[model samples]
Target: MEGPIEIRGLTKVYGGGFKAVDDLNFVVPKNAFMGFLGPNGAGKTTSIKIITNMLSATSGEAIINGINVMSDPKMALADVGAVVETPEFYPYLTPMETLLYLGSLRGMTNTEITNRGRDLLDMVKLTEWKDQRVGKFSKGMKQRLAIAQALLPQPSVIILDEPTSGLDPRGMVEVRDILKELRKIDVSVLMSSHLLNEVQEVCTDVTLINRGKMLRSGSVASLLNEVKAHKIEVRVLSPPALEVTNQLRSFPGVKEINYMSDVVFNVDFEGAEAEQAGLLLQLQGMGLKVVSFKESGLALESLYMSLIMESR
Candidate 1:
């Protein structure tokens, strides 16, 4: 199978010397559900805009299914669909009417339009509201309608920006399931979201960025395991006295120490449990209140923070 998306050194610069993207590179294998993650203003929307041929990039290249997006936008977009930040619709139009309207733009026949609309509304669990005016619908309802329209073209690639926005927990799960169902039919997905938990629940591979620079990009499992350097948090009862941290700081493999709250301290180690034990003993010897200790799992929030801090 051909690669669904290929990007290399994708960069975008605006007026006033502002750069929205900088040397960003990634790929979404054909039929793969790839997550695009980043904090606000991390150039995600800008990158997406360039990919869809909505905006021209200042440099670099991207191809979808063997067609360069910049070289032949029509052919490149023939099999691609996207739902940018906020999906729009005709206020007075029904869900079915909205989808059929979009289908007309794609040159779908009336029969094809009606058939596809019914099938998609059913797929999105909005069959019951197909004839209802979209203006009266809730956010989730509107999103479902937008999805129906987005799929009317039968595109191979579906790029969604913040699919879970305006959705409650159950609605979010529904959208996630919709994406999963798309994967089963070999649809390539490129989704962008800052909701780490949602991405963790749905995406297989990811590219995370901050300040317009790629922080980490790969399988979620590998990225989570990237910080293998062991880190632990400890709580003490008799809090260490002044200058007491200096003694433990001299121990081998102790990278750094941080006091979180008055009684808790975080220790960075180089995977030496023996050295950690020795250090703990030294702290205990100081007659400090040794309360509890636990391993700290690397969280997405922490990973994001580390990326932002490293950028600074």
Candidate 2:
């Protein structure tokens, strides 16, 4: 079956001969939460604009649900919901009123708007303030409401551009929680974000881009597997003796070990998950009280940086 979103040879150029997007091609598979990752001015937003039919592409196709956006924008976008860049609404309108108004624009009947609007308000945790004016809401609340509005249409595909941008830490977390909820539904999502941690947390698949060119695209697990080595931090109740440390250093796949303190150290491990499990078992068998064992550093962050650097 065709994916919900596909880009083939999509490119965008400005008047001065500068290309903002360059032949980008990828697919947002059915029910997949895909992250569109890139650095600033890397053409992430430009590509999204083309896909959403907000801007004309220099060359290429933006297909949504098997419909070409350029050829039939209204039909192509009928079941598409997008929150592009920062979202703003009339301060005077309440959340319900706002949805009702937007829904009307989308040709929804009054009954349909009220029923879905109420349910969506609850989904976004804005039920208490559904009737409250949007002007008094915080940035986080507004962002949440924006997501609710996008979902009001019961879209088959959801597109978001930096949904958590310009928000505080709590606000970012709230938006991320909403995104997590999105994954539970049947819709396919394409979220454009530069924040690696955010993408890693909420997206199952990722496509990396740099300078408007495609770098790599795959499931998060597959991309992480491309990183042959992993850093793991282990904490024990007490420090190990020098001989025990030496034994640990000699363990298979232990490239290096650095002691951060008496009970905490990091292991540069070179192997897959099974090898990592072996290392953990070896630690427990050493007669040390193991407190915690977890991977250190963002593997995706490392891959993203390397790809971006290489592209440059």
Candidate 3:
């Protein structure tokens, strides 16, 4: 099936012959929340620029909803909403006023603007500050407002560039929460980010890239399944006895164990979800009060790092 967003042979070269994007190809499946990931200088931003029509591609096609972006930018991008890099807004305008102005530019009626603007502000948890000047708002608030503006037109596809890049922990959580809410909507999202945990938490699929080249791309579960083993952290209510540790070490799928302390240890576990559940049961059956049993390393992070290393 044709996706909402597709890149075929996309490439970008600067005057210095620096290849920012190199023959990239991928698709943002309909209704899929996909993360575009890579390290610094990995061409993620450049590819997004091309797809959003902010920059022209040297050689390739950026097709949005099946329309060629370079051939008909206005039409291709008509159904798309984008937030690129740090979103900047007029410092003097209130959130409502900013939305109204941008909505007008999109040719929305006053009534449509007011209703949609109010709804979006509420969705992003900015309804209380809807009338406040943007200058007084924190970076997190501004980012939320930016999202409201992007969604003002009710576009079908949303593109975000590191939506949580510069926020503090609280701010990052806020933005991530908004993204989770976004999942409830029917829009297809293609977000570019380097944060592994963020993607693992919110994105259903991921596309990995490096030095302007495609590394791997697929649904999160499929990619994670490629990981042969996971490092799990197991914490018990009390320090485990030697015999308890011995039993744990002998458990099936437990490849290796590294004790962090008497109460906590890391297990190199080669198992599926069912096996993991069994391991937890086994720990409980041993009369140990398990406090936590969770994967210490993100499966996506492991896969992403390994692919990047191989590419280098």
- Rank by TM-score, descending? 3, 2, 1
In TM-score terms, candidate 1 sits at 0.79
Count of backbone collisions in candidate 3: 0
Candidate 1 residues lying further than 4 Å off, grouped into runs, are 229-302
Candidate with maximal TM-score: 3
Using TM-score as the yardstick, the better of models 1 and 2 is 2
Clashes of 2: 0
lDDT for model 2? 0.92
lDDT tens per residue, model 3, 1-312:
479999999999989999999999999999999999999889999999899989999999999999999999989988888999887899999999999898887789989999999999998899999888999898888998888888889899999999998999998998999899889999999999999999999999999999999999899999998975788999999998888889889999898889998889999888788899999998899999999999887888878877898998
TM-score of each: 0.79, 0.82, 0.83
Candidate 1 per-residue lDDT, tens place, 144-217, comes to: 77777778888889888888787998888888788777767768889999888777777887888876678787
Once fitted onto the true fold, the runs of candidate 3 whose alpha carbons sit more than 4 angstroms away are 232-294
Candidate 3: TM-score? 0.83
**Candidate 3 lDDT:** 0.91
* lDDT to native, each model: 0.80, 0.92, 0.91
Q: Candidate 1, after superposition: displacement of residue 181 in Å?
A: 2.9
